[model samples]
Target: MVRERKYLGAETNAPVSIICNCCCKRCARKRQRRCLPPEIIFNILLHLPALVIRDVMRHVCREWNLMIRSPYFIHHHLRNSIGGIIIQPLFLAGKSTYVVMRRGCLEISEFDCGFAYAIRTSCNGLTLIPDSRDIYTLYVINPLMKQRTALPPFPHTVDIHSEFKLAFVEASMEYKVVNARGPKPLNPPKQIAMLTIGVDRVWRHIDVQHLPLTARTALTTFPLVTGGYVHWIGETFVLTLSAETETFCEFPMPQLERGFRKFLPMDGNLSVVYCSNELSRDVWEMDSETGEWTMLLSFDLKPLLHRFKDLFSNEKSVTYLGWLAVREVLVLSTICFQRHCIAYNVKTGEIQSFELGTDCSNTKPKVYNFVAHKNSLVCLEGGF
Candidate 1:
């Protein structure tokens, strides 16, 4: 059936002009009544998939050029997709550090810290630090969003020599920093130090009449989906603190041939990395349910040593490392050696490399540290 066309001003309208096929009989009236302007067209294109929208609107007009470049559009795209992971290069100047977001990648605002030693993410945003110095003075920050909050200092006097690790416990929604120091005293030890975040007060010292320290100790906090927990690694013992109860309990470390140990959080589970007697690298995951350790990945460093002789032999070769799961892939970074970065697809076992340099001109890669958060990837630029 043929229907009469409607026009914007129809009282005395002559035959409506047929401009294009898009202006079919039904749409002809609406088109005549209100022609689609560039703004409307741009908005409609924004709702489409990125590739499809780009392909169709590339020839649409000039107005979209500015709209697409606008921060609103950029942020909208970034927030909707798995945004980019950003790593700031340490020691270089010209080559700026960058972040990879869905819309595209961008550089982080410049800071005076030579290289970031640690990176973290929170509900508020991301935080980067050059090193662990006075725990009392550290501040958490989100570089991309330019937001920051001064973290409360540790409660007790911490040994400046010991290394520290941080984790966020979701159950309590609090952040905790754990420091591992000297072995237990031959004589009875008098005091023990611990730190907690989001507490109204600073760190508080507890008497250690019952706690036994060992030759090699480690402190780490893990964020489990149900709740977060903190662990203290002694030479042969493991102490776990439940975030919900704020109580500590003892557990045993797997009897593995451990020379040196490193800890990381992976897939809501605790991961331990160490060098075996075979001088190969081995990774283990802790099963919270059974409290048993399961070996995940073992690699022959001998092959890597031969291939990257210069890197492996360097005194700066990274010793301590952590892994972050990004889009079903595991990204690893080290601190002992010069900045060495690698990623592995857990399922496929495919490996990729990341290069970090101080400046754009530095062909030699440097090392850095990295951490993943809810919405962003953060890396500490430079060797620690």
Candidate 2:
């Protein structure tokens, strides 16, 4: 208890004290009114990290159920993560249908079908198969999502006598379906038709005025670093078409077994696997930079056939089997007489045979396709 002192124009009744701080008077006043409860404050702080928010809220309780199920969450998670997987449901040669794993899981949030021949994913996902005969009435179904889309008949005049091919180019965001009809006169005897995605016109005919006839046999498309391109092989010639330019350019083949060689992608590179005889498989790599062919591996079928005689009776009858690279090892699967599926490891040179049982009720076990996902091996069993 002290006597009050008057200084200048102010009066002090208690001991004088100084409070040092950087916060303004208004900020301190706002902090008092905005202070939340401990639990509520903790919840708000947890949402600072996206994953933490998802795991905590999604798995917390039923009240946060709606928050986890929102499309925004799904899209965000997928876009920031590695992607999704796509499997192709195909009927194999054994009267059974199997799904072939194409790639890893995709981060697609949604998808829709515009034409029957293809389904477009939300994030620019599209799959097209051109050789489908029933183009106009063809229907595409996504077994995963149970979605189907039917396409209108192609507007161009279809020559029923010729074969067709289809492909989807991701880089150019174009869907091209090329139909090569009967031979044309005075034009190298080659007829061509094409359809571009997002374009509302039927396939237009291309004049093969100077295009070689030997460059239009099996039309196929593949993805390139720059963009996606189409490769067409006829007789002994090969041609590549750039989706960006929509023009065709001639390419060279390895000159080895040009008739029966098969094209495939291997280890992020374009490769060709050719069989000299039933018991021999040769793999060649394509030099994307210089357009050169390099031999990768050559395998002799004698050892593998001898070790798995139960699966392969005649080594000469070993047809071109599907191949996939697992880790650093290349796995080759071959079917003999359409009865057994034999797998071969190119690195360690190990042979493992999986019998394609002939149980009618169990579905013929033809190794239609096989894909390695993470640590699991998914096989597609079908006829052809």
Candidate 3:
């Protein structure tokens, strides 16, 4: 038996159309009304921007509201959404103001955390921030939604010396934060603890007896999420933690002299940016499965350095802060008396400087950390 399909708008209660599939075969005129499959409707909705869907489309009708609220729909929307860059959205991490660059436009906003805090990392538009009010308190926050979830305190003692790593797992659809305690004057933690947001409130210790843990950098260095693992710049190797298994792995990094190295997420792979030599900078991508490294591109900065000697005081000093893939530009910062940041277009060789506004002088000048994220319809309550 076939049933009639009815269409209703949110503003209007009366059915706009009715379609009976069985009668269409009996009478050609009855084919005026047609019905679309749910899959087809979902596909059509995926083409819309996430902001539009969340802000406007959801209010169109009750059926649309339910469709937008579904986790499946949210994930599909995220999969199809174009990524954006949010610069320093978590203001608690620094004294500088928040600036978000989305859809080729810059928007500035204010963040009031009420207390001292710092951002650990951001994944899928959600950031991991730690509250300075407590020694080991962490919060998973969606700054856009003004929603936050406080993580339980670390079972062991952690101080300012502890290092925190955060990443979002696409496979498991969960966010994981690791607290790697450092050896200190007091009782030091023997094992590193890991916790998955929305699943466990308590931290689970990872057994690293066979694999020794070492401190490579400060907590200020954020982790890069790629290939189902969170990567941290280690002393002489890249430290990786599996998002699902909560295990650890180590991989060697290319040797570079006279300059610093930075790791960033690019094109769903882990990217390494550093000076391959004194006159040139190189960007390399790594295959997480096979542990293979491929050089993507090399840029000669010697001529650019000569042109702007004041900004680039030293010829070999260049640091990569982030990659804007959509714009085909790389965000680079020079080491000088006053920090200068510029976006260098890889394709066109065009360079443009970005300022952090007039109030940036009061805060410490450092390379701003950027994460590639897409505006998503993911809800804070659902664990996606």
Candidate 4:
């Protein structure tokens, strides 16, 4: 007969056979078998999705609880994870909301955040959001684990035009939130406050130099992390912020066709999508080493004319979200008739559409924010 083993360092599949009563007695008299080796357990757990590990496996026992919480496991998990999209709909007047829609899943899991007007970009699976009740107060949250911590309020009133950015610093293994606000983009921000949570609760100002002439233009978009730098797309150039060094570098963007331009993080670099002439679109990738741009794919909305005539008729254009490398599909959103998205296959010219269901009617802002995300065990604790 076989019984469960709980001793550490034990082989997971090895069983001691007791053929006779004497052998059984001797086995029982001897020290109990050691539990499974940590290496073997780690290998087994590494294959499970982050949701399973966070919700199910972590609750199995004390050993598992500690294993999942360990820094080693967390780093590995965050590195290998492929995240879904975090959808935050800006309704007219209702409770602020957040939800995650994993690719290939029809239903979404909602994360409760009390009435908040803005949902900041996510970094390593954690999102920083301003509390609706008090816009000055911020909450850093891991929706998958339902873990959250509030940040100390800003010394001065937080501006509505200010942008919030979350980033993971590898050197210190910490998460930092940057609040950048200014009346114009070309000029340096009036105030740039940064806080490294868990290490210091106080916010400190960052001294930025070599400002871009275009900085005077107000920034309406959030920052994206890729290739070890946090990037913000400006009118003339892309602003790159080093996560480790906390410094800024500017790179010029490829000339566009005078339509719509968007920057998305993909394949470890910045991917740019520019739409022009109302129907023609081009997708390019920037080389991190040489700063060269490469055209990966192009799209013609002519084929979509038959199915999505409403889009072309009303002059509504497509918004490039991100790419699904594993599936080789391009993600895009549109608001021609209503809020919806299209998944266009790169290898094969196939297209599918999905309704985002954001209830844009009667909303004051009438806009929704969407971002590509992956679940990570990047801990919110510890300091640099």
Candidate 5:
């Protein structure tokens, strides 16, 4: 379905036209002769993918463009959008560039960012790019819309590992930029910074001294955002923060031997992937209300070892990307410098693997999509 574009940031050389079955120019001519009814056009376009609506359909004519940009259309389009794995090269200020889908399907796109910034996290289709050189500067951007809203710089210093995340708070009916990561665990910052998307040009400081979890930040784990809550998975305990209440909660992680444990959002609940060794990995689901853990399934990756024997790094590492709730689990893993990802069909026990194509000779720090991305015409400043 996405043959026109290459995976992992390669652009489609051919132009796309979503108007009728004709090319863009031909469709324009047809439009001039006898335009369709606005109601018909709106209904027809709503069924099309967000990428098509954003990149091709909206450019068909002024009338279509106006309709696509309307708040109602964007709102409904987002509601209908399921979103997918969005990957963009984490380019440092002095580094090269790359791109992917802002949301929905398996399409990736390239756009003009004007300058370089590594994408740290994304929520509800909007990506949060934290400036590498400037610890204080953060950009909340809609890659599809090619628009951005930069958060004012922080007044003081932040930990090098101070990670940032973009999240939506259902209770408040607002979006927020959260930086709960603090300095070295032993000397944690007394307050964490958060900014309400549209209303705050400046960050609102919240006291963290009283938080249930220790002052430690997610040094290595990428926090998971779901159900208006931010969860940080650690070896011993799980730390959670409520975006709405500005409160923190901690719970014990399942007691298992030391292994690589990652928290994934599965079927509206928190799922855990634990790999005790290179041979097998177990997946578990947690019930937040009762603090109970359920064993979902286990993936015996050992049988698939030869598939990556020549490439897998020391850890034989497997990083969970995202998943299709109905069937598959997508994960990123493999090779020394280059990247490889796989999608496992749980029902069929099929492991479909592909390369993300890092194409490097040596290893270095890199970033990938921490969550499924959605594409939106949402204007951060406008609070849409």
Candidate 6:
């Protein structure tokens, strides 16, 4: 063929052009066949660690950066995310220490916050940390992202064994912080403060006059937030607030004065946990839609608490902190003098204890709190 074309150079040029055109068409077809859909790309990236998404994958290209920060991606990441137990020791717990036990692993990680704040509760990957020096000064921090939002201070001191809460308002699709400052024996804040994240420039004060007189006398330590409402233990009843309507609802909890009763959010419903010195633990679930409370899980902590009795003093107490939903483990803090973390398996009925630290001060605990923490790349309009 070459010998025949050697004498016809002009004819060979057309054949060469035809071959080049056919090669270009084949390359185009290959590119089209190999290109992946956006949905498939999203699913593939979802399995990667949040650190990879924020640091490595996002920087790979502009399209990736946009998708990683998108709302849908953030929402789905949160939905599939697994949370761990975050522990704050009482003494240095206020200032520096944070102990984290991640899910599906036994290894413990501890780090210093490099500041002073009593970490109280976590909701949707953010924690409500109130300053230990000034109880009214509050901050919402995403420890995993190393982002912090210092909320405006309250007008006065919230001194009555206060508990702060971070909750979401479904109607506005915004996060809200509630002071939940329980009443002190001496002075009680006339009005409670509420702040709408990324919306309210300053703290919004709501009067407590409409609330029951007992509301001023006592406030619960644990607050359950679902949708737009936040529920807390009042002096003698359960107090709920609609963050959207700014209205209030009050209901009575089961009358149990002998045990350390705390409110827990469990199984998409509100749960009440009562741990007594009598070595018994009762978990009651309440239908979120209906205000009905039903006793479902009752377990004897004798076998579970017996093995860890050496960790606490004779006057030791057991408090059910919160449930680890993905792991089916109930977090309990056993404290007589020092605090020890005990995880109770709901299915296996087995318990494992963890010490916060090995040092002497770590053994003698203070007013620390433990909450479920999920490391998420939840980008908000607000600074956090």
All candidates' lDDT scores?
A: 0.47, 0.43, 0.62, 0.64, 0.62, 0.64
RMSD of each: 10.6, 13.7, 7.5, 6.9, 11.3, 6.6
lDDT of 2 by residue, 1-384 (tens): 334345422542434221112234667878768966645744453333333444465566554545444444433432333222221112332332121222321111222222323321112122332235564343323232233344345555444312333344545535555544534322333446666644635557676556654554334222222114445554554566554556777767777753457665442235676777766777787654345678888777788777866655775455543343322234334442444544456655765544443556656444343321111100111100
Estimate candidate 1's alpha-carbon lDDT, on a 0 to 1 scale.
0.47
- 111-183, model 5: which lDDT tens digit per residue? 4444465565667667776655675677778876677877777655655423677667755668887775555
| Residue 63 displacement (Å), model 4 | 3.0
Better of 1 and 4 by lDDT: 4
Once fitted onto the true fold, the runs of candidate 6 whose alpha carbons sit more than 4 angstroms away are 1-36, 44-49, 93-107, 111-114, 130-137, 158-162, 180-190, 219-227, 255-260, 275-280, 306-309, 312-317, 337-339, 360-367, 381-384
Give the TM-score ranking, best first: 4, 6, 3, 5, 1, 2
Instruction: Rate residue 177 of model 6 by lDDT.
Output: 79
Clashes of each: 15, 17, 0, 17, 3, 0
After superposition, which runs of candidate 1 have C-alpha atoms over 4 Å from their true positions? 1-7, 10-136, 152-166, 172-208, 215-227, 258-261, 277-280, 288-290, 300-320, 326-337, 345-347, 360-367, 370-384
Model 1: per-residue Cα lDDT at residue 171 = 52
lDDT of 1 at 48: 51
How does candidate 3 score on lDDT?
0.62
lDDT of 1 by residue, 197-243 (tens): 54645645555445554412233222222115555556665666554
On TM-score, the candidate that comes out on top is: 4
lDDT of 5 at 45: 86
lDDT by residue for model 4 over 1-384, one digit each (tens)?
A: 555444522554434443344566867666335557779889888877787887789888888889888888888877766655655555424333232334543334554433355455667777777776777778887766667788877767666523667777777877777766644544556456678778776888776544644642323356676635667777777777676677776777787756677777874578877776677667788765346778877777667666777664533555666765433566666653335666666556677767654444654334656666666666665310
Quote the positional error of residue 287 for candidate 4 in Å.
Answer: 4.8
RMSD score of candidate 4 (Å) = 6.9
Score candidate 5 by lDDT.
Answer: 0.62
When 4 and 5 are scored with TM-score, the better candidate is 4
